[model samples]
Target: MFNYHTLYAELLSSLHGSPLEKWLPLLPEQINQGLCEQRFGDLADWRQVLQQLPEVSANKIELKDKIQIDGDSSDNTRAQIKNLLQALIPWRKGPFFIHGTHIDTEWRSDWKWDRVLPHLAPLENRTILDVGCGSGYHCWRMLGEGASRIIGIDPSPRFVVQFYAVKHFIQGGYHGVPPVDVLPIGIEAVPQNLQAFDTTFSMGVFYHRRAPMDHLRELKATLRQGGQLVLETLLIEGGLGEVLVPEGRYAKMNNVWFLPTADTMISWMRKCGFKNPRLVDSATTTLQEQRQTEWMTYHSLEQFLDPADHRKTIEGHPAPLRGVFVAEV
Candidate 1:
């Protein structure tokens, strides 16, 4: 019984009479459909857990150096906060400091942010969209960097709940911050040709698509003319025109369709009508960046790689090498 209607109305109110007002009429239905379809079996239980969180005011909210929520809370209350967050296991994209508790997620998503931040157009006062934003972690960082507003889309119900949990603290404590919201939807759910955002980010998502060109086109459609596109995905070392369509699972990740070389990825971007595609940063994902943590106890990148050859996955595909590219729509 999460009041999505109220949430939708709030979103509409925030956007009313703005440039994004065109989305108001259709957004409620789209969000409702997405919420219904993506409902997890344990969604009710998750919502209950969210309700169980102790009410505490975050007197100091920090997002510049790290995502931290600081306030005066007794140790017992801090323990309660920690236990409540632990229920949302498999936290995959953050290292959020809530009160006196630290929820260390599987991926050091901050590393990825650092890599992509330097090469992009300034986010200040821009309407930003984050495709496949897990738990809205990067969206918070985008807000920290001075974005006017940000909307993140992810299909995972757990992620949506986790985002709301964090947002609860922020909104309860720090009022008057710029608007940010995470929709329970996929990239495909985005209305085609909306063309509303100043910057659109598709990170760690392109390779997961069955049809990557279509994915690129979808990313393109979300941006206005001359807007920036930040693309980050897995890549392999090879010359131009070469790409790897994983024979099966790559690094134990199913549904990973393609990993193109840097040169080839630039070519694909150009073909999709993106201008001045430039390879910005490329790095191999390391255990330090993604590994099992107390909050995310599941097996991670270390377990997926080959013991015999670290350069290859356990399934013998090339190991995880990521590339970041920036292009213009």
Candidate 2:
């Protein structure tokens, strides 16, 4: 087993009297529901990998520019660490270096972070909520920038396990476990209108929601009064009021619902009562930023695009162009 009881204990002790204390009563049951074996058959296999990871104390821990952990493990132990981490494949959000292994994920998530970090309010001492944070890569980066605490939410058990794999080394390397956690639950599981965090981030998640306006409202509710909202999502080049409701799959993703213009999204934020919503950064996702790596050997952005035209997806929709917006609640 992966010893989820320990995770629960740490979260309870750390959050007992914090601004997020109210969540302590509900976390255990929610975490259990998210990790039920019947729902995820591979959970046991992933747990076994975690059990088998070599115990090595990291000599250096760096999370500022990259997630790098260096230790004095013997070469044999480093090889074993690499093999164990390989079992958790299709890594999506990181390029974490542990001991001597580089687990380069499909998305060069660091590039996305570089684009968004400069435009936001300072993260120092801020309490943050990262919705749909896969493997908690950005959560670690937030901690590096001096966040008081960070809570990441995602429903996938695989990503949750991957986070703990890196976190294990962090605990061994640092004096104590840092105040960062990735809960195996979605944003919907959070108590509504709690308004606790200083900053709320919803990145690469807005288009997947069937109800776009509701998603904005949900992001708003997670923030304290006058808190900042950092939202990054798919966008199409068009005027105000223009939106793309893909007839079928967009970039071979079936669940994507709405791709809006930058102006349209800003208008929607205003309607949801966000203040001074403005487009901060906008760019087309390139092959270099997202591609197949040895760690993530699956179809990626290259295969999803039209063979004849790089600007269009195979289904003739505009290729993915994402935008980041900052607002105040």
Top candidate by TM-score: 2
Name the runs in model 2 displaced over 4 angstroms.
Answer: none
* Tens digits of per-residue lDDT for model 1, 1-329: 55655544556787888767777787888777766635567777777877777778879988777899878889998888888888888799998999877888999998999999999899999999999998989999998898988999999888988888888777657775448888888998887888889999999899999998999999999999999999999999999999999887898888899899999999999999999999999999998999999988888989999988889999998899999999998
Instruction: Score every model by TM-score.
Output: 0.96, 0.98
Give the TM-score comparing model 2 with the true structure, all chains together. 0.98
Give Cα distance to truth, residue 41, candidate 2, Å. 0.4
Cα lDDT computed for each candidate against the true fold: 0.88, 0.92
Residue by residue across 159-260, what tens digits does model 2's lDDT show? 999998989877778887788888999888998887899999999999999999999999999899999999999999999999999988999999999999
**Global CA lDDT computed for model 2:** 0.92
Candidate 1: the clashing residue pairs are none
Best by lDDT: 2
Q: For model 1, what is the alpha-carbon lDDT of residue 23?
A: 74
Residue 49 shift from truth in candidate 1, angstroms:
2.0
